[model samples]
Target chain A: MLKTRIIPCLDVIKNKVVKGVNFKNIKVMGNAVEMARYYSLSGADELCMLDINASYQNRKTFIKTVEAIAKVINIPLTVGGGISVLDDITDLLNAGADKVSINSAAVKNPKLIRQASIKHGSQCIVVAIDGKRHENKMKVVVKGGREITKKELIVWAKEVQSLGAGEILMTSMDTDGVQNGFDSSMLKKVTSNVSIPVIASGGVGNLEHFYLGHLTKSTGLLAASVFHSGKYKIKSVKKYLKNKGVPVRL
Target chain B: MKKKVIGLIDGQSGNIGSINKAIKEIIKGRPYQLKIIKGEFDNSLFSKIILPGQGAYATLISNLKKLKIYKPLKKYLDNNRSYLGICVGMQILSDQGHEDKTTKGLGIIAGEIKKFKSKKLIIPHMGWNSIRLNKEDPIITNNLDNKDFYFVHSYIFQNIKKSNVLANTHYGKKFPSIIKKGNIYGVQFHPEKSHKYGLNLIKNYILKS
Candidate 1:
């Protein structure tokens, strides 16, 4: 059986890993390689390394970071941030990354998703959508969850899937740092509307949150503060989910 | 003398990082020279060849043929020189693959790769899973006893002759985790991405020669 995935996202700047509240006021966590190795051993299905400074640098550092982590951890690694071109995706894949997550790039040019999927296969491309509940509707955000896009959440997700994205890493910007739990209502709206796998992110403060997140049609769960700051280990989360009758890798 | 090697049948497809990493790890403490050859494969310069892949079975078979290394690879395996395959590389050894559509394989093994269609299970079984040993094969010895290794594929080798199955794993079905006959060894999982147990498995294969 294909178990639901538990992914820990790392926000890397320069060469160090940093975590912040609502994507601001950053604080250094620890060594990127060490953190990645810990997550891999702690039973994380995959790890996402987002180069938060990728747009500013104009050069993708996620690929180099992925290579470093790949040397230690034996799990799938997805590299994102500043992945604007087909060559960027190809370079990361060649550098041992299992998948590439596109956020701002995909929003700017949705065709990149179609092109990448055709050349590298849909399984290798992940379309990450950062959204917020706006005006009674979920809206997409870009530039590391700073700028809002004109497209609606469900509409853009369907378009991206139609364009050949294999999975959706949907994050709720409103509940990102709130720790209230995932926005299940919004998750259900987006996930139920798409046929591809949806990974729910944001507002995960406890095991119950993960349980609820899974029930909302998400194929995977993503967290940072809870998993990174030692609030909870992924093994414990998977165990909890297993006990709750939720299918997870234990 | 340093042993020179050739990776059989290079194409624009397949995961090359895994193959390169496996070879490097295999010869970590040994004396051996390795080279990745493309277009045409001349068997005389290498003592062993590795076939690594991650994609559909038909694409891999077609790519190998297009590169013109398919015949040479077949010839190498017939003469009984060392060869190692990972993931889809292992699937291609079977008589056929049943993904998207039925397609023919390299016919190295007596079985066919079947897709799991149970509504109870999900396609592409991805993550760390345990393997139960059926028989003693050198590639999986010592390290494979009740040990879990990472896996990320959908199809499993079915109807495999008991003589060729080296290891078995239970997902939705009991399937071959490792298959070996003569000089050919096929692993359904990516050993390069599977940590110590996986590294040790590759080391065992290198040590066998």
Candidate 2:
């Protein structure tokens, strides 16, 4: 039986791991390699290394960061940020990344998702959508959650799924650093619209939020601030989920 | 006694570092000399070869052709030198791949690699999956005992010979997890990433060969 995944997002800047508040005000955490090793041993199902400085850097630092982390951790790693082309996806996959995630790039060029899914397997491509509620509707944001796209969250999710994105990682920018809880309303809307696996991201402060996220039909749960700041260890979270009758791997 | 040189093929399609680590862990403190070979692989120096990959099947096959090692690999296999394929490397042993529809594979194994069609199961069957041994094959039987092995593959081999199947796993349906026919063997899961059982499998492979 397939179990729900517990992913920890690591923001990388200039080859160092950092955690920020609401995707800004970055604070250094530790070496990328060291942090990756710790996460692997600490029972993280998967690791996502988001190159937060991708838009600023001409060349994406995700591949180098993935290569550095791949040396230590043997689990699956997903790389995102500034992944615009099939070549970018190819480079990351070749650099030991199991999956390549596209946020702003996929929103700009929808065909890149199809092209990448065709060239590499759909499982290799992950479509990440940053969402924020606007005008009583969840709106999709791009470019590190700065630019809002003129697309509805549910509509874009269905489009990406049709474009061969095997999974969707939807993050709520509004609830990201607040940790009030996951955007259950947004997650419910988008997951109901797409048939592919939906990974709920942002605002995971406590074990109860994780439970609520799973109840919203999310196949996976991702967190950065909560896990990085030592609010709860991943192993303890998994144990709690198991105790709560959630179908989590212990 | 001549040391068995295991050729680690590196065609730049995927990282071979973890595979090398598995090999080192398998050999342990023993004085067995294992050599890592790159570029157009010359199989003359090694008794057995290990092909490991992590990317698209077409890219790996294309790169193998570009390096002009595809024919040599086939020739080595024809001569019955032991060959082991891991992950995408295992998928490329088939006749064709669905990822890139028109791309041809090494055809070492008589099967086609197709995307696992399941609305319920994830495309890539990631994480630890238990392998049920079909028969008492020495490679896995000596090490693993119905334990979970880590798997991360989008495409799985279809229409493979039952005689070659050493073990099977149930994702949506029971599929071949480990296939072995004579000196050629392929594991759909990554034994290197599977912890104790995986390393034990690798140890068994190194010791038996």
List candidate 1 segments past 4 Å from native: A1-4, A41-43, A56-62, A144-162, A188-196, A214-219, A234-250, B1-10, B98-103, B113-115, B118-121, B143-146, B154-163, B170-175
Clashes in model 1: which pairs? none
Please give the lDDT score at residue A39 for candidate 2: 88
Q: Which 10-residue span in candidate 2 chain A carries the lowest summed lDDT?
A: A55-64
Flag regions of model 2 displaced more than 4 Å. A55-65, A84-95, A115-121, A245-249, B1-3, B11-13, B24-29, B32-40, B54-62, B95-110, B136-138, B141-146, B195-197
Per-residue C-alpha lDDT of model 2 across residues A1-250, encoded as one tens digit per residue: 5567789999888678887776677789877788889888888878898877875463455566678787778667888876777887887777777778998888889999999877776766889999988888888987657888899988898999889897898999988878888999899998778777788998888889999998898878998877777879999998999898875555
The DockQ leader among the candidates is 1
TM-score of chain A by itself in each prediction: 0.95, 0.95
Pairs that clash in candidate 2: none
Q: State the lDDT of candidate 1 residue by residue for A1-250, as single tens digits.
A: 4467889989888567898887689899988888998998888888988887775553445556778887777767888877778988988888778888999889999999999977776767889999987788789987656788799999999999889787888988988887899989889998778867788988999889999998996878998889888989999999999999976766
Q: What C-alpha RMSD does candidate 1 show over the true interface residues after superposing them?
A: 3.1
TM-scores, all models, native as reference: 0.86, 0.86
Alpha-carbon deviation at B189 in model 1, angstroms: 1.9
Model 1's C-alpha root-mean-square deviation from the true structure amounts to 3.3
Question: Residue A131 error for model 2, in Å?
Answer: 1.4
